[model samples]
Target chain A: MASMTMIPADCSSSTAATTRLLPMSCHKGKALHFSRWVSLSNRLTASSFPSLSFKARASSPLISAKIVIENAAKVIDGKEVAKQIRKEIAVEISRMKDAIGVVPGLAVILVGDRKDSATYVCNKKKACEAVGINSFEVHVPENSTEQELLDSISKFNEDPSVHGILVQLPLPSHMNEEKILNAVGIEKDVDGFHPLNIGRLAMRGREPLFVPCTPKGCIELLHRYGIEIKGKRAVVIGRSNIVGMPAALLLQREDATVTIVHSRTKNPEDIIKQADIVISAVGQANMVRGSWLKPGAVVIDVGINPVEDAESPRGYRLIGDVCYEEAIEVASAVTPVPGGVGPMTIAMLLSNTLSSAKRVHNFR
Target chain B: MASMTMIPADCSSSTAATTRLLPMSCHKGKALHFSRWVSLSNRLTASSFPSLSFKARASSPLISAKIVIENAAKVIDGKEVAKQIRKEIAVEISRMKDAIGVVPGLAVILVGDRKDSATYVCNKKKACEAVGINSFEVHVPENSTEQELLDSISKFNEDPSVHGILVQLPLPSHMNEEKILNAVGIEKDVDGFHPLNIGRLAMRGREPLFVPCTPKGCIELLHRYGIEIKGKRAVVIGRSNIVGMPAALLLQREDATVTIVHSRTKNPEDIIKQADIVISAVGQANMVRGSWLKPGAVVIDVGINPVEDAESPRGYRLIGDVCYEEAIEVASAVTPVPGGVGPMTIAMLLSNTLSSAKRVHNFR
Candidate 1:
């Protein structure tokens, strides 16, 4: 017999539950509503045990517990949090400018005409402007050589006004990503993609000049939400150099006992269920189900995957690695896909730029 | 009623069971005998569940199963493995020299008069000689300035003959260890302690010029013994920069799902039981016991700790982080302390030096 149990509605059990649940009328609340609406309409036909979709749910009693929704997860308002961070960064930039007569500057180099990359660059520039930081933009043609890209990076490396340098990723398949990323000066590497910065992040008692923006944003969200990381069991799914890897390092640095589950990891659901915190960045939509979560676990979904959505004007809509409806019922708090990590990345870039400028000018 | 289960004596169950168990009369057998003698006389009074020493064993049914030992774990003879590795390295060195007229050179800088450091340096020098490699030794006074040490490192860094430069650890407390270590050029950092090298090691698709000796030795043992790593669940019992961290990274690179259990971890025994491979590097003697292990798990005990031993010549004897007597009864294969990881470290150092020289000379 398949046994079913009710998921407790209690949120007070989680340390992260201290975060105030956002009102349904707010921007974050709208994200939750939209996520659920899409999930209910499109994915309702799938099994409730999405994490166990590969296995027969009846065989694994552990993941067979039926989720009875009474209270939804506290929607972590990354949009609201990013806004607050930007305001704080703006204040710091103004204070530094007033004291040292210098403003923080961010330089972004975009290669090719990929629509998504262009959109990301535009958002970052707007974010810098709103935060009172100088923004420099460069566009290289798709056919440009790797040396040309390196040349642009070299110019920005020497620019005294450029406190941060970012080269938008997926630079034409012909370009060597490693060589180009290495060309940015460590001091000016606001993206924190340098191997040196990553090494420092992994080592104990060593500090990276700048942490990668997306992972930094993820940690910042945990901090602002008062999610306890110390002595907790953290599971980071995926091992990409940018997000999953750095996020695990950051969590480990914060004293969390971390396990990394990658593509080769067998029975990932078993590992995920052991975590007090789950950060999924595998870029697979709805991979993590409620059955994979430990009760009261705080989830930070870094994957922004697109799934077919015939109801929408566009044929596809963005979703996260976690199943929104399922995770909300099981997790104590969850980050929504669109408004969560997306906004935080730009905010952290601004923060890094401000910090770089402060360090250069010797400002407190 | 307490239930007792007989532990299966089948060595064929574990993938790592392919390693032939050493004869009881060999050097590794002496290690087993000595470990058992000490354990029987001194630690026999303690509970069989040493991993649950802090907990009441009867309270946890999972760990309460009585052990009916029918088979001992396959004793991994690291001394034998290291000897084989040395021969391989010697052959490579000879071939490289014959091919390119270049002999690999390793420079060791010892600052303080620490007895252990001196012993280690002496062992390294002898190992290099045995492998037909040039050895350079520099001894600086305890009262020497940091600048003097840095100057010596600078000379070795620029020396065309020097393939590897190693600064003995625990330099005079007054000198900055980080500053001294960073002085060694990355190319000559056979120790693999440089941040850039570690960063490269951690990132996917990026290769480090060298891997830290001890961790590299651990992996090499598994490879030589034909222990499977891919898709296995590996738990590393420590987070030290040199051994535990790099060991975990190496395991992950080999496609193992790795979790690092540190001092901050809660319920480490629970985590340990889930692992197919256990690498304990924590310096606590006899910390991991029978109850913490999975029946077919392979154990690599990296800790070489000295506990009080009035019965021995030095008034103390060395043991590993794992309780050998208990682990042997429970695990499929286990590496003994003194004869295990100790010899492998120096062999790996020799291998790294040879490789560095090969890279410098463009020798295959």
Candidate 2:
């Protein structure tokens, strides 16, 4: 294990300026300085020590000593954790089928020919197959009417064999997205994009039948990695319906002191630096720099942006909202771009399908 | 005008201990002390300067000089503001009625005979009358079946003349609150307790046809006063589905960096002292004291609890979760008990009903 480098004394001078600008009289002697590691360490329990997420540190000689000395965050292994969840879902599905002689099923309605949409649909189908759940996909043409899409959703809603229904987003330009989503029966709304499900998610003591997959994946990663969310300060840097907003709501449900920093927010960097955990889904690659992060922050990056990479075989490579190179040094733990939330999304969809099946069939 | 009292130097020692206990290295040199008035004075605008809501100050010259010299918060006059909004609503209702031959109507379905519930319903009916919106009432016996209540809601849902429907909360234990609330049509859900409306409120860029009244009133208070929510740190002290949860969500929509402090939260006072604004809805009398407030912080007390008072004619008096005496000296602005959020809730309910009517009739 590498001995961690101490944070330089002048790292928090910018925050000192912000403190001066605040109207509250209590804004002095509490601006965060990286030099105060002693008090920080005292506040954390042994289980929550930043080094726990670094399981690959010993085996991966690719990790540089300089980065390691700079307090490299433990890499939250989302790929591995997602695989574990899929295995559990498979077992549950198998047990339910054996007990009731019925297999779980998912129905996907994808409109238009967007490359990204097709790829996502294909991935979902493959994932359902991997877990032995039946997949029913309806691919309407790009020029299809809203009525045609609603009819397909109606068919899935009425079919007892299909326990889950998902309408792929970025629907055709002419169609009303809300109308189409609301058309899906609440029981079959495994995508959890329906307003009712989201409402249930927002209310205390009320559980949504399904949580939106991507945000659920983010929380699942934290849970799988044994990170404590309750009482911790969390900053979510986006307010998108599918990811950022739901992510913030879910964090609040888990009792994290959650703050959302969107496009209109001022002093975002200053706010982000105060979080014990940071979830960035702003879709702007490398928007979160090293300075934006509090030292020892656990970061879950949900943004997957494509950046030009001439060296790669493909025309471009995916980069997350977080500046990985910069964040890895300051954070206590981080989830990588491609492998972090992406795999977990598919896993959650499968889990939702399994749960829906169990619920409908009473095969718990 | 009575002189405001100055806060003592040693008022925030507990916060100092909490500042020392934070795990984030960024927590340094920012502990609040009430003695610092000059910096606080520099941050406030003219309209927002303390004393605006202090309507009782002149009449009650008994308000001590020591307390007056201490920074007295700008009093947020919810009663006065609600009155102005009601007047505006009256004008709108008249114009709509004259043009469209239809008056906005609100239906209240009250179950049980609790004195408070009766008073609330009566007040609502009176408010509707004042605004020239027709009022319809349906009172069910406490022993009525869920079906009976549902039947009444269904009738109002189908009534074209009724633009809004509210089922008084704390329905008999035998009835399912969720089931009955869901029975009200989404369009008529002016109380904004419906899952769909709440979901819309939670989603970014999506608008709820109606927002929950209490929370809406809280936001309206801040807006009418020109208190900037965007980029400010706000602490909502509670997570009730009715008030605290939605209030936090609404504040987030306004781009405030919002943190919800609940029962499980650690060092709530310390967390609260950091906020530029604090909204307390925990229902505990005087739980939020002057020491818990950051000097120049804006306080919104949502809790309305009755404490036994031998001197009062009723032998009890209503109080807020915040200790008004202490907070008035520390905050930049504060909403007083009885006249604060109480008046605003009904104002918001009327506003919601009026908006729903206008939306339905295309009167706007």
**What's the count of clashing pairs in each model shown?**
0, 26
Writing each residue's lDDT as its tens digit, candidate 1 over A1-364 gives: 0111222222333223322223335434545554554333322221222222223323343334332222345667677778778877888888888888998999999999988889899989988888899999999999999999999999999999999999998889999899999999999999999999998998887889999999999998888766788999999999999999899999999999999999999999999999988999987777787778987788999988766667669666777878766676567778988888888988999999988988888889
Question: How does residue A157 of candidate 2 score in lDDT?
Answer: 94
Per-candidate Cα RMSD to the true structure, in Å, reads 10.9, 11.3
Worst 10-residue stretch by lDDT in candidate 1 chain A? A1-10
Can you list each candidate's DockQ? 0.65, 0.51
Q: For this target, which candidate reaches the highest lDDT against the unseen true structure?
A: 1
Look at candidate 2 and tell me the lDDT of residue B305: 73
Q: What is the CA-based DockQ of model 2?
A: 0.51
TM-score of chain B of each: 0.83, 0.83
lDDT of model 1, residue A69: 28
TM-score of chain A of 2: 0.83
Task: Report the CA-based lDDT of candidate 1 relative to the real structure.
Answer: 0.80
In model 2, the runs with Cα more than 4 Å from the true position are A1-71, B1-71
How well does candidate 2 match the true structure in TM-score terms? 0.81
In model 2, state the lDDT of residue A66.
Answer: 37
TM-score of chain A of each: 0.83, 0.83
